[model samples]
Target: MEKFELDILGCGSATPTTLHNPSSQVLNIREKLFMIDCGEGTQLQFRRNKLRFGRLNHIFISHLHGDHCFGLIGLISTLGLLGRTGALVIHTVAGLENTLRPEIDFFCKDNPFEVKVEVFNPKVSEVIYEDRSVSVKTIPLLHRIPCAGFLFQEKQKEAHLLPDMIRFYNIPVRELAKIKQGADFVTEDGKIVPHGRLTIPAGPPRSYAYCSDTAYSEKIIPVIEGVDLLYHEATFADTDKARAKETGHSTARQAAQIAKMANVKKLMLGHFSARYPDNNILLEEASEVFPNTVLANEGLREKL
Candidate 1:
């Protein structure tokens, strides 16, 4: 069976600490790497994790905050150093060109790589990017700036029949595709069969949602409903609720509440505040509200 995995690079909040870096994550789905947020030191974390920059073709920048996108310029420059000729697509909010374009041009005056940055003005939450393998959409979130979250839904794969069943039924090569597509076979003798009789149901498609540096908002529930996994920023503990609200960030309990309301299978809480000595309080508070709550640790890879 194929796998969808999330490689957590940095889980700390605005400030970088000795123990943790900033906010960067790599989603490894079906051999494709989608990067979410490229905070400072993210490239170094990528190196520590042994992830190749060539695999990162698509990038989603949640907001223009320095902690979330500061490392992007350096990463791109390194990609050029590594002789990456392939095109890189980045989906971000409008008005980023004013800040990002000049930097790219400054560093890549005569570079060979093709970098394409697409800005989406989301009026409402819906599917905005899609290919054969997966689809990505934006979710409106309440942040200090005009920021939004992202949702990634992997396309369901076709089912394959057991080898013994294929051999016993004498299924032709042409009929194999049909069976995998949930179609029953009809013999020349006019035999009738149901799709379920020949093949089992396909596994559920994997989905992930990323909410970074946003205040607790229920409006995003519809956009991330039934996601297999959710990564929500819990920049503060419940004791710092007032601070979280002032800073337009969510507490661990608030993040978990959203995860529970969205009915997500698993919840990953990260973006810890610099004041916190460790992530134990954040994890404990989130787990109180949602049992499947987990702290996003650096270099941790969770498979879905």
Candidate 2:
């Protein structure tokens, strides 16, 4: 029951409009904030949503497109201005250092915190980051540029202890940890108390996958198989398939196809084109193919 939520900051494509900003989202896992894709006006959206900036330490950028990363510098500068002292880790492609280092040096010279950029190749899928509770892996995506998606997977937890069984067996408190780790207990009378009797099965781990600015690619289905939630780009309708193909984007139908192929629990369609007055058409199209499809709107929060 720990917190696992996705907060949508911006969900529009390249052309900014009055209805939406750009691409940005915050993944809150057990109160640890991991930002994905900081597009234009991201800071304003964050403030409007009242998300705590201090809790955000790591950022994952999908690509180098302006709409995907233009707000990064501004957000970094504002964090410095707010007297943030913790280091900020940015996981992105290689060439970004050339553009961001100089800007950080000139604009944030007096800032107390440090910005650490970790580069990863977008052509191959690999584990990029890992901690005690979660592990993040890169999903190579097909885009105009070298782009990669991210998969957030939670680690398996220990088995739950059964208090009633423990009391009946008179198991000592000091032996609870061992029992949870699948160790058997021996009673004072030399009787065996199996570990299965003292603990119940652990809950299944949950996972989330984020894919944006990429064309329909089946290579990612195996990597994102059976995820709890999936966020995919739906930049056009079926009528605009030609444009979607030329721009290395996906139509609503294409996104739904990928979701169905991957067999994810729920699908979220985002990165909407500005031409559509409302996303009802896109939603309906995706829902037709994948029944659990939902539209991503700014300030929307989904819990997994």
Candidate 3:
């Protein structure tokens, strides 16, 4: 199986508390790192977790909220100071470029690396980034401002070769690649062997969705349906539903409702309100609706 994991750096909402930092996470797919939402103290959290700065090349910011993007400047400056020469790509709405470019130019005047900003609309669902291993799509979210979520989906894998069949047929090593690509094999005598007979079907692709700073919106269900892992904001408990709505945040129950509606494999809730003395109440509230829900916390890592 391909290696896919998520590392939580900060999970608090609005402000950083003594117990929690704000929104930041790193998604590791096949050893490549993609950072999501650089909130305050994100670099410190990265240091605490010992994440390699050089490995991270792309950052996807959901919105312009302070809690979601306050740490970006500091992180960029630190990367330059560390002598990183690789290009850094940041994907966000176009409005941020006007606000952030001046700060970057001033602080990183003599930096060695290039900062590439790729803007995407927060009102449409579209493929923002794609490579051989995975593709990332934008999920238009219902937040106070123009906000968006992200869906990281793995590409379909090649068929698994049956070693016993290969040995029995004395198949040439050079032909294996073609077979895995679904081509039929022909013997020297012109006898044909179907590719299906020599290989097992590939495992289904895995996906992860990140939704935050948005109210409960069903429009995202089709985009995130059946994802392997879902990280949704649950900033308030069910008792605070009104507050959640008024603030463009989702309650724990609301997050769970979304997860259930999407039929996701698992739900991981975060963006907790500082008012909560403990997050267990929120977890319990979400679990009542979706039994496979878990709470997001700093340093928590989930592998799929």
lDDT of 1 by residue, 1-304 (tens): 6768999999998878987788899998877889998999889999998887878899888888888899888898888888899999988888777887898999876667988999876446777688877999998888898888889999978876877777777889988888888888787788866667777777888999999878999999988998999999999998999999999999999999999999999999999888988889999999989999888889999999
- The global C-alpha lDDT for each of the candidates, from Candidate 1 onward, is 0.88, 0.94, 0.93
Residue pairs in candidate 2 whose N, alpha carbon or C atoms collide under 3 angstroms = none
The TM-score values for the models, in the order shown, are 0.95, 0.95, 0.96
Compared with the true structure, what per-residue lDDT tens digits does model 2 show for residues 151-186?
Answer: 999988778999999999988899998888789999
Predicted structure 2: lDDT: 0.94
lDDT of prediction 1: 0.88
User: Model 2 Cα displacement at 279 (Å)?
Assistant: 0.9
Task: Tell me the deviation in Å of residue 23 in model 2.
Answer: 0.6
Best by lDDT: 2
Q: After TM-score superposition, what is the CA distance of residue 66 in candidate 1 from its true location, in Å? A: 0.7
Ordered by lDDT, highest first, the candidates read 2, 3, 1
Task: Mark the regions of model 3 whose C-alpha exceeds 4 Å error after superposition.
Answer: none
Total clashes for model 2: 0
